[model samples]
Target: MFSSKIVTFNKINFLNKLSDGFKITNKSHREYFNLGHPLESPPTLRGSMVVEFKMSFILDNEEFFEYGSPVDIGGLSAGYIGLENYKASDLKVNFFDFDKIISEISAVRFYERQKFLEHEITESVYGILKSNFNNDLADFIRFDENPHSRLFEFCLAGGYKINEDHVQKIHIPNTYKNSLLMKRISDRFKGRVLTFNPKYGFESRNVG
Candidate 1:
């Protein structure tokens, strides 16, 4: 089974919020990341600029399988609202191969969401994603589901560079290509490829 996580950033107020509300059962952990010196190790550094909320979700194998089913969210059953405070800004997302660090941070949110949704797990998750990411780029979004794993996929445009402020412009590599397994959006704007870890959820601003 797969897990999910959502991270939000109120760029205006500079507030960060992370939630693991998309799990199979309801066992998740949410906390704030301390970017202070010593603690600024690997994981912390990767997530440094974040200030305020840090959350997580975790689920066991049995519970995960039971609630990881997929549901369609096209019409009424869909609980998505359009993006809030829509702004012309840049966003980036990154997909990682299963590793210990990724698994641990992601597991917290994955399990938490499962527990939150005693039922209606799939539909609820779909709604949340649609509401949060439904922009001019919605068509670029994708998902992966398997008995043992699951993943959320998407692409970003608009000159956003990795490890830089959203306002800065970056050039995309000319080698970028589109495929069934992966899609590329290359134009005058900077394009980035992103995939979310179904288990760990998402990170605000750090989507690259």
Candidate 2:
């Protein structure tokens, strides 16, 4: 699904853009402003008037994926409505998967790793040892913090299943350390772990 949080500002210039107002210049101050008050007449006018508008859009997966560039939406060039004066916060959009995309990715990674190992250990005598290792790894894979509980349950329902019988433990060192196991975990969970910051807006298309 696709979602958007939009804020608009209504300013005097907006009326001018609509060709409903005349520009009145303050010659002494070298400044110009719109004279017409479309909503309220001059006698009833107060100081300057500003309005803020905020709207959210939620679209289905197909629509969301089809969103064109922001520039095509008129973006900042769209006449102010009052949105500029108000500070809009907490704008977020996340794509959730009903199917266990993370688990699928993890399973693929495990299969690839196992295939690589099988190619290296060519000796038939090590078949039993390899089988034991695979079983242990699969057990470890199933041992999440709470196996019964799903991550981001409220936002996205359905649970992912751990399929591997033998997976490696993630281990990292302080010195230029890179653990393949840790990388797998990060790749699987990165989408859920990262969040949009109010101070710095962010956007994500997928949960895995």
For TM-score, the strongest prediction is 1
The segments of candidate 2 whose C-alpha lies over 4 angstroms from its true place after superposition are 1-93, 96-145, 151-208
TM-scores for every candidate against the unseen true structure:
0.17, 0.13
**lDDT by candidate, in order shown:** 0.25, 0.22
lDDT of 1 by residue, 1-208 (tens): 2222222322211121111112222223222111111111113222222221111222111122211111221211232323233322222222222122234323445654553222222444444444544533332222322211112212212221222112122111222223221231222123333333323322323346
- In model 1, state the lDDT of residue 67: 19
Clashes of 1: 30
- Runs of candidate 1 with Cα error greater than 4 angstroms are 1-112, 115-121, 135-142, 145-208
Candidate 2 lDDT over residue span 1-208, tens digit each: 1111111123333323212224323322121111011111112222222211111111121122221210112212353211232221111112333122222322344544343222212123123223433433223223322221111111111111121211112111212113343244335433322222222211111122
Candidate number achieving the greatest lDDT relative to the actual structure: 1
**How well does candidate 1 score on lDDT at residue 47?**
20
